[model samples]
Target chain A: MNIVENFDLFAPRLINKKELLSGGHRACSGCGEVLAVRLMCKALGENTVIASATGCMEIVTSMYPTTAWEVPWIHVAFENAAAVASGVEAGLKALRRKGKIADCDIKVVGMAGDGGTMDIGMQALSGAMERGHDMLFVCFDNEAYMNTGIQRSSGTPMGASTTTAPAGKVSMGQKTWKKNMAEIMVAHNVPYVATACPSYPLDFIRKVEKAKKVKGPSYIHCFSVCPTGWRCPSDQTISLGRLAVETGIFPLYEVENGKYKLSAEMPKKLRPIKEYYKSQGRYRHLGEDEIKMIQDRVNKEYKKLLNKVQCLEAWS
Target chain B: MAKRVGMEVALAVAEAVGQCNIDMAAVYPITPQSHIGEHLSDLVADGKIDAEFVTVESEHSAISAIIGASGTGARVYTATSSQGLMLMHEILPIASAMRLPLVMGIANRAVSGPLNILNDHSDIMPQRDSGWISIFVENGQEAIDVSIQAFKIAEHKDVNLPVCVNIDGFQLTHMVEPVEFPDQELVDKFLPPRVPFASLHPSNPVTMGAFAMSDYFTEILKAKDEALKNSKKTILAVWDEWAKMFGRTYKPVETYKADGAEILLLTMGSMGETAEIAIDELRAKGMAVGLVKLRLWRPFPFAEIKEVLKKAKKVLVTDRAVSFGGPGGPVCGEIKAALYNEAERPAIYSYIIGLGGRDVTVGDFTSMIDKVNREEVNTDTYEFLGVRE
Candidate 1:
């Protein structure tokens, strides 16, 4: 039982938390998306329900008569995940008012892919946030519409290759810049909006824990690398994620009320963006000029985010 | 015993919703369907009905609000038509999938393109696969009667699905007819309270909606499909109980003098009355003609339609909507598919008629019948009746 000693540290300290996500899922081998979800479930523990949209996660989890979700789960349409979660939260509250349910700390969490969070499901998300439902919305950003054959979505990074935004004779790759979903969530005036990457498991886990305690709507945007869609090595998923944060391409930050704070502060001397870009095949076709363009965009956005955080800190 | 009085179909539906003692109603005013919401709202505001009248911003919000309220184990109702129904296209499936027992009145109307607000099936036809049990009422009396029965069918634990009662806009909606208002005590006894499986309460915190990963997506969908399909028996049982209590009988497919008929005219909503008159005129002329009224559209009475149309040699299915490049109108195409494999099925001639509030008379129906008899029956086609060429 040498494995017991290895498990003792993370497992014993970990309260064999009721597993919400059962094993034996149908996700592809070494699927980082599901792995990120598994870790999220571990952090969320039991006593949680998730409202998911239609995507790779949904298709692979519940097949016919069997289910991989141990907890009570519901799969609505692609765009109404937020609305459905709101209904769940509202329904639970109503039952409590009627004195039907016991006083337990149960939470409702909404999970969806980038497309569902940033584009199609935006209205429902906005509505739920505006209504101030007590729930958590977690967006697993895998860049493109991985479930629907690598189509372009708002979360797809610029200069990345997708079926709809393929690198062509004239075009470099995805023409548009990645949508600022964290800022969008903050604009709704939700209680919390934070960005995390699976590469930083402790940080990602901490964000999920913080979101559960928030009174109103709390949003968590997790960067989940897609090996199949991003054309990267399966083993390089964590490294690529780490490179993203280190290169200042995807800065980790959180917005509490109106105050912005950088979760992981980076030094003024940052690594070259080329180190992150060249590691993935999706950006392999980029020449020096294209790489320079992408690096410039990333630097500008990061600087803007830093300025917002600094200004908010000074004012508060 | 209850006194019967003349009432518009929309008012009848409103009365039925009130009598059922629904807890919440989220509605938006739309043509033909406006009266249904207005009457219910008036009832709620005036203390005639103890319910929450949520005046939503749009039809989408109306349905969304109902889903939220219903998810909280409250009996909820709403009414909309044409573009209003189209606006609720996204939330419709969500309501059904969550297994909420929501009842809605759809004043059937032609969808806009040429900007028309007339009686047609174009509105409800697009929602055929939306997983709600769709019931069509021919007149004011049936609208009142069926609406009461709809709550029973929708809220039954075995049939936790949404129900849509469709009445032709400007036809049955505006037309006044004798409707028997059942006693409120009887309605309260017959329609039980809604028992939702999940709600948003702080005490017993059970989640109503949750994310299903690839590990469990198909099972949820299959369960939803089975629940909807299995609800047919409950729908029939509820209708039977309603008929027994109120002494008004209803069937999925109601046939009018179809026995031994050579030609059968099939229609839904108020147009069934027009077809009945056409049948009477043709029968006087020694023609073996009859009329079949479709009362239930979803959980589409396939077996009943086949049984009713078994004896007919020629079936004329007149639809008040067109399906563009599709197989004639939506209903006719569905009817065709239902009877496609039947060895003794009759010939179905689909005619798109009475669209955009065009007046549909007995004469117009007779002409369509004549075309069916002449073997000039247009199959997989559309013909707009009573229109200026």
Candidate 2:
């Protein structure tokens, strides 16, 4: 069990109290991505500036004449949040050194959704990370582009149906496996890279705080469950995220300074992947054969991750 | 004391920008704008300038980075040319709409297809509707002077718009000439540190670049339009202040030898100086020819253009970039629209000239005048100055 599992919603001690995101946002019901953003903001605290890409979060929070952001937030375009955040960080560095602004530790954050991060925004993100900017980029991966309807993005998992890649007579929904965005960020050799889910609030918050303190670039990939797009009951959002972890569909881990550390204890006898798949209507069309195929693929990928962790451990 | 030294125009512009005490610059290298970025980077690296020079991966990121920096109330700068400018086209209007008050130096060049990296207005012409306060420089000195003035004009309280200073690629950017740089103290006295209207900070957090729906979209656009339109007053005031301090006056539409001229040849960018030579030669031959140089592009100087062209009987409008099939050229198209409502407009002929580094010499100007005079008719459309069949 995780800290989130032991903590109560009405309790006072765990998460920070500052409300960086106002409650009046226009996100759809049971939006795990918005919850993740809220949790991330809480971890960021007061001295943070966010550059958001055009996505569900941006559209929902910033509808002219009104804003749900209690923090300084900027939305420049769809794919350049990372680039913009790099600029903001550089600007702050220059300003502070020149004594133009107050000398304080302010974190620059770039926030985007799956499509913005995995597809259109890949280049800018890679550049910012490579430049070693003191910033963090958070990609709220809800599998597909939910803001403009359920269009399949690079982050969309195979066997999950979407508007663009629907389950038709000859198609098996998304054609390819979900991209390992965390591994990709690790390849950038950024100081910190983490995979988190808002369902585990403490885990996500801890990773964000760790990233906040990193002097160089950091990345956090949040698995945001979209009930509206996933066609699941609103109440199942949290449980389904848990099911994903337990079934080896999604794992909770962090790589800090090239060291792999699991955020939570790996479930001892992984649950069947069918439990996670059955919770979402997106994968309802998959037959037994397709389910077995996905199950085998998940196990193989999990083993690959375990091999990485073990190899690093053996060296230590 | 101001220092006058022979320097490449691009390097001079970079030195001028460094004098402004800018907080940040995110620029990508693309010729002939590459010199501007390279010099600026050196200035930052060697502690010649106290600014952050972010070497961005692409023009898109360059514009994006500067926008983010400017949102923090820091004066920012970047330079690009041709396809680089096109890469920045997406964020150009966004910058103006947000009113971040950054400045960009454009080494104007032809846009691609054949992919020629040479001097032309094709790069900047397409950015006409991007709501930037654009201006063209004829020489290295003008480039340096206007580059300094750009920060002043952009950071003005009433006119918080990004300014684009266009120096024609290779034609002006590569030209080595003596450019007088204003004293650092004098520059400081003339241009104050940017007083941001609403900067992003933790103490006073604000949401910028908010998405506007149909209900409020028009009003937001209207406000940006009004800002660009009203920027003219601030531009003139800044230039007036510069004249007082530096003894150089600049006009939106500057005229040369037009006191009693009936035939006028209007031009923009670096070609204006070559045409001046042609005007001198033609005047020596007892011809009544003059020049109207377009200095300001956007918030298009309609009144100033009309006021200058009203007295001329025949006008030869030279545009450096073609407008495809729409109109003659971007500048000429705007000129035509500007004079369409006038009570008695002059007979106008537009020629797409000096494209893709095709040199427009003194002879070319004389030939264009001859072409207009020999063809006794208003050119409803433009003709390529010397493009072969």
Candidate 3:
């Protein structure tokens, strides 16, 4: 297997020393969030600064004198990463104007987990996007509060089991569908909004690059498979991310200026959602009826997205 | 050559910040503190000041955004009061611990319950251990002076901690007074552009606010504590320099007619002015009473407070905020602790007064002094002065 032989013509040019996110950190084995972050940094290159929310990524990468981040990074608080990113962008602009910093090409990236983006940090994230600052906010969506022992988050899909929303005899796991954060960001009328997966590295890298190019606030909701919380085989992290997109559970798409386009549209017959569910213990309690309920929800949402893409294409 | 004009205190503070040529400002609308953000926004809009004025959604983001902006090496400013301060309480320590040289103007107001938006120290009192250097002003001129000095002190090489300049809400923020705005050249010479100790630049690539475990957490906290405690010298040095350049002097604990007084009164913020008037009237009655106003609260100004109170036979401390079931008012409690180890300290008396925007007039001050002189109150605990029976 020649490393350079398989490079796709359309894929981002991968650089050597691509470990902006180095190894020897505390992330669980086969952590898909770290992989997504690495691909993002590869796309953004060395001239990027990150304001990370307090989560698995932050706690794992930055532990005192030891750090995995080769690029500049700051973690202020859990719910204010977006706000802090706003400040970083404004500060860089101010510093550039003052001639304090010569290079003005530095990009500010706001990184947060699903909990940080969908619930506690929603206000700050919305404010940052609405303010139209030049930055990218990436939500590594692992579904539940993986860093805090699998408590349920708004991003947790229905029928998925979590500590807070367990599948008891009388109740389902999560009562509601996963929050449509990418759509919520699109509602802010931002310049760019996209959803990507770590299993599809090229697509994830491409979306991050596109987000970087957009002038104002851009957002990318990346699907990160948490093996620890999901109780799946550690080696199955990347496979689960792939299965999520293929099963129409987590669609890979982008909204550019209200124009929707699916980055990886599924085949004529999408893979059964049960395949994705059965791979993780979070959904082990779901019976046939529960699986059908999730499949119905997934199908309805996927059709809605497809209709949006078709409508946009017709207008164009 | 300096420009002196009568302006509203909040606007004056905005103007002084403008004069410092800050790179960005994050504003949130909170009463008494709103006008400062409004005026700063107008300044940014009118191009009177070249800065980025971000109108944030809430006080939490306001501090959070400034933390980010300051992280990138931009000189930034923000303002809030009362509940807004409470909202910002969580992030205040982050700014100090990260050692961001940001400046904030707190229009001092009472924190709500009965929900009052009036003058008091309750807003800043609860934030005592947030690791930011706290200063208070007595008038509009001092408000402008201290607000300007705050940037310098915060950005000082040795003291790269955040600073808060507390101007009494409504009493100073809403009132118009003659404030001497320093010349741009003077300010330029005085405050060189902020030089951040560790900025978030892609070229340098350093991590800030990293997670520290038990092995290093205490030492990191100790370092931050030392920086705050050592900031007193830089604060004094900055004030001394400002006096030489602007002809206005400030001290941590400034006195009023305290020379050879048998009794002394302690106060913070604008209440010092009313206390002074009371001192004059009492001195005419040959009571030999004086006033000692606390200009700087944090680092507690322990040495100066002890030195000033050591001479008086009896000292009365006024606090606008309560410790609720504690021995005394918040300010008075600190005073007691500071003087606890002193070989010779004053017979201290604590009074809780002027709360929830209640007026404390010269008459009230005199009455309190009379009560103390007559030994009518218990020395062990604090009394809520001017309370209805």
Candidate 4:
């Protein structure tokens, strides 16, 4: 479908205009993570239940009686969101089997921040995937532990300024490179795994729709920018996300089973990594050599991902 | 008519689970309790039972898988011991709060630090407040009998909470005894199909385990508390129904020969049988002592315990579990709390004993009662029984 036609056909059909994520949320104004969640909920529609971990999304939305969520939601401990959602999905299925529930399409979604996804919740997530449960696992990658005061997470980009990986004279920011979670998810050989960005709302919606159609486990790794944590202007959330994809720092792709398809392939002449980095204050302290080091690492990782995708396509 | 057969407590539990026609079992092998899962898996594989047996990686996943399977409105069962029980601790509350009638066999063993995998109540004691109904079986026969009863109690509409059937690890689980296996037809008649209050159904959809705000959180918690407390009567009713069919009686707290006794020895799990022998010797010596076996740990059996203790001048509470820094053991602390306001409450002395499968001889029980009489009940807590240097 053409861009306009695609928007006309898919946007309204998928968009859940009912704002489940209401305003007045304590989330920092223009929090990209919440926007991504808002858009995702809209795409998934109302017949859905969410299991959230103890993270920024959970803390900010569920403040006693004043909940931002309009949908039925559960906030279990940090590492057990996947496990809890597994229970919810199983409970729903059992009820269906017993004729307690009528035939209605329902979705179980798990939302976790980077730390919850790639670190603490990893085993539970792996187990859930291995079990082949019908559910969606969404990882809002803000790179650092924003809610817990910007600690380093596996999703934290190399040379990024986080509380645990602070920039100093002898060292750059985070020394470790960002973990390729989408690839890791694909390695699980699940039915679907896709990468998306909030900046590309239509693209993100498409991935959500695709994941919903998949029979078994699906993973969507959304590149969500944290304006407050990244030391960028609140309004720059969407623009930074766009810059990430355009600069080839966060390429969009989908892996269905073992097959790979690049969703948004940029031209060979991409924007400089510096353009993407310099926009945020997290990378402001990076010296010339450190910047080059980060750029080299990013280039190598991007090339590796591209090669893997290309090899898979060639074999298929 | 099914033929009666002698079976180990673990095997009897497995056979009962199969006979009950459980839909699914997620199990991880742990000492003592491992036979329950192993036997169940074999039964399922051999086509003796129609069920899904999931061999999980860890005790955490075993419980998590059972929670998932049970949530689906399928009858589910699993078994675990000491550290394994501790590992599944996180999922325990979830299972209960969701109102899933999940029945688990807990082979009671000491919790590890120095790593002992033998009999003790330390394991299941920590899980008392997690909202699961805990039933302690003193012998092999009771283990099998209570396991079947656990399903009925758990699935009862009034008592829709998970039930833990606690059998002392090697002492009960490994010991073979004469267990009357109820006919499958009789079991079917007594325990009907589980009608879950809520489940993962597409039609008539209702949210379970929804996040409650402070405005509604207290109400939900209060409801859970009320459900558990109100279930005491339902539990009694189920026991009565079970006894009528199986021809064996059960009580929340069973008083063994405690009529007008001056010294009351209170014990739980397999240690009660050992204490019974000691009680016989003490009674013969004119010590005026009797034994009270705590069959139900959760829902505490408070009123019955108070009633039984009223006739005794001194009560010796023997615990197979220790509560490190706390007064007495965990069970003793709970018993004290239950009896605190009673006007005629007897002098309660707590003794920590039989930890890590240490054999409890008749001498240990006799000496403990003698010490209780001679020493003026000086301390509310003492670990003098089987205390190692």
Clashes of each: 36, 0, 1, 8
Comparing 3 and 4 on DockQ, the stronger one: 3
DockQ of all predictions against the true structure, Cα-based: 0.14, 0.88, 0.84, 0.28
Q: Write the per-residue lDDT of candidate 2 for residues A1-316, one digit (tens) a residue.
A: 6664565553338678888998999998889999999999999998999999999999999998899999999999999999999999988898899898999999999999989999999999999999999999999999999999999999999999999999999998998999999999999999999999988887788889999999999999999999999999999889988888898899888898888876664686789999898878999999999999999999999888888787887777
> Measured by TM-score, how close is model 1 to the native structure?
0.81
Off by over 4 Å in 4: A1-27, A45-49, A60-73, A89-108, A168-171, A265-267, B21-23, B46-52, B68-74, B94-100, B202-223, B374-381
What does chain B score (TM) in every candidate?
A: 0.96, 0.99, 0.99, 0.97
lDDT for each residue of candidate 4 in B1-389, tens digit (9 for 90 to 100): 65667778888889988888677777888897899999998898898986666665678867766766565577888899999999988878877877879899988888988899888888887888898888888777777778888898898888889999988888888888886778888989988888877554333333444455678877877887888888889889988998888878999888877998988889988888778899898888887889998888887788888888876888888887777777868877877888889887788898888888888899989999998989745654476575558
Please report, as a value between 0 and 1, the fraction of native contacts recovered by candidate 2.
0.85
lDDT of 3: 0.91
Task: List interface RMSDs for the candidates, in order.
Answer: 5.2, 0.6, 0.8, 4.3
Model 1 - which docking category? Answer: incorrect
Put down candidate 2 lDDT per residue, B1-389, tens digits, no spaces.
Answer: 78789998888999999999999999998988999999999999999999888988899999999999999988899999999999999999999999889899999999997999998899998898999999998899899999999999999999999999999999889989988999999999998898899877898999999999999989888999999999999998988999999999999999999878888999999989899999999999999989999999987988999999987888999998888878878888888889989998888898888889998788989988977878743577778877899
Given candidate 2, what's the lDDT at residue A141?
Answer: 97
Q: What's the CA error at residue B30 for candidate 2, in Å?
A: 0.6
Q: Give each model a TM-score.
A: 0.81, 0.98, 0.98, 0.90
TM-score of 2: 0.98
TM-score of chain A of each: 0.93, 0.96, 0.95, 0.95
